[model samples]
Target: MPAATRHLARRFGASQIALNTKMTIETIYIARHVDIYASSAGYRMNWVTDDWQSVTGLPRDPPLAEYGLSQAQELADYFLSLPEEERPTIMLSSPYYRCLQTAVPTAQKLGLPLYVEHGLSEWYSPVAPGTGLHPRPASAAELRTYFPEIDESWQSIYYPSRKGEDVEQVHDRANGFLRALIPYIEHKFGGKHKRVLLVSHAATVIALTHELIGDRNLPLRVGCCTLTELQRKPGETELIGAWERKRLADGSHLKDGATREWGLEDIIVINDTGLPGTENAADSPVGLQVDLLPPEVLAHV
Candidate 1:
């Protein structure tokens, strides 16, 4: 949903946000989509208990598998390589095995507990029973067949398909879940500042941030694992709905000098900006005023 225009007035506070030098504490939410599953796994969107296990094969519930353990370590290595200051306060995942698995190493790197917020969960696209790599049983009798624990999970409250946790449920849960952290973010950034990091899906991030910043015109252009940083003025409202009108990357509109084009910047924004942040906005002057270093420039730093 787009944010209300009425909220636009709150974007710039009484003071001129276009100018200010406030150091803000940041929360880096890594939107991870590290490839864990093989491509042949087929479509498994709204996969249920049996389906999830078939693809991920018994998630590492405490005692985790050796393969899973190794994957976590590798992921942690990647995270540790990053500047220590960018470490996230809350390490979260989309409640998926792969995501949780990815976070295992991240949590280790950050030395923080993994907090499961339903808002960070993945969107449901309804995986057909047999279409999955698990290949749903030909009959109900066969489908019903499963280990006792798997059977128990069918009725588990945390399962994704249990009435209240559908696709729509995910969107709603995400909105509500992220709302809880707004104040914490405000405090972290010292009042209406911005932060950076990663995110997974495109929809939920757009929905949540749009509502948060109240930008109905927002055209979110965020992609997976691509590093992006946002900085806001102290009095200006936090980063929220602008998905429609602007581009998030610093070089979104790079001219015809083919080689000077914006690379890996949002892969391709959901909107014209090709990014949800400043890289693609009319606010380029303002964005550059604050973000002295373009992403390409920062890579070497």
Candidate 2:
């Protein structure tokens, strides 16, 4: 280990050093944003009503519901209960209000600087007719006003298209972030054994999981405040090692487990499969949701 790494290990403790030496593992924890006050028809309006657009002045970006706030607190308590060595060393969140709101408590508890990463921003779809363009998310500087812990010094790895991103574009954005982020972490933190927590939307969580595991066929479960863990051992070359899905979208910490869960079918449609009452839907290839990136794209990581 380098001098900086040795210092970090010593600061953390001897046990952490031993653990790092034994496994040399790095971890990424991807968390989906908690539920928001949505405007869906027939859904109960707790904080906002049907005219939520005129009420909040934010049609697309809604704040977390009352229940979601409690869930965020629970998440923080869960992190506090973990051993120091197992806790996250760095935290990143999407610029969206919901994601930032979900991450704030944990960031405060961990004493980790919250960095706004556009690469991990919510998946953007094309504008619908008569619906106008989707409102752009708050910038890092703007987010700082609400989240004082936000570290504005760090630059984002990638930014999504202004118009919107298709499914493949979203997948590519996630891949690009992974490729750039690993090297940046190695350089900034000066160690292989690092734990990073990313708070983002359901689509982004699924996309990030796909990129990390290098598998698009797996059925991903994304729920409000759910955590999906990705892990990899240190490699000989400069390239980061291939990643494995250590944990699916797990929301065991929450008192009410896995609320407002979203699946592959929610984001992508495949021959009307995976729909309710579809024949043999459980075994259908709808599980093969996202298309794998090109071989060259995977090689860069």
Name the top TM-score candidate.
Answer: 2
Cα lDDT for residue 197, candidate 2: 89
lDDT of 1 by residue, 230-290 (tens): 3333454333331222224221111111111112223422211112232222311111111
Estimate TM-scores for all models.
Answer: 0.42, 0.73
Worst 10 residues of 2 by lDDT: 281-290
Write one digit per residue (lDDT tens) for candidate 2, span 1-301. Answer: 5464466456665454442222233778889987633322112233456444322244467677667777788888888899998888888898877788889999989888899887787776754333334444666887787789899887665666544567777777787677756655554455653788889988888888887777766688787888888777455233333677778899898777776778766765222111223222222221111133222222233
State the lDDT at 100 in candidate 1: 52
lDDT minimum window of 10 residues, candidate 1: 148-157
Q: What lDDT score belongs to each candidate, Candidate 1 first?
A: 0.35, 0.67
Candidate that scores best on lDDT: 2
In angstroms, give how far residue 112 of model 1 lies from its true place: 1.6
Give the Å shift of residue 253 in candidate 2: 0.7
Model 2 TM: 0.73
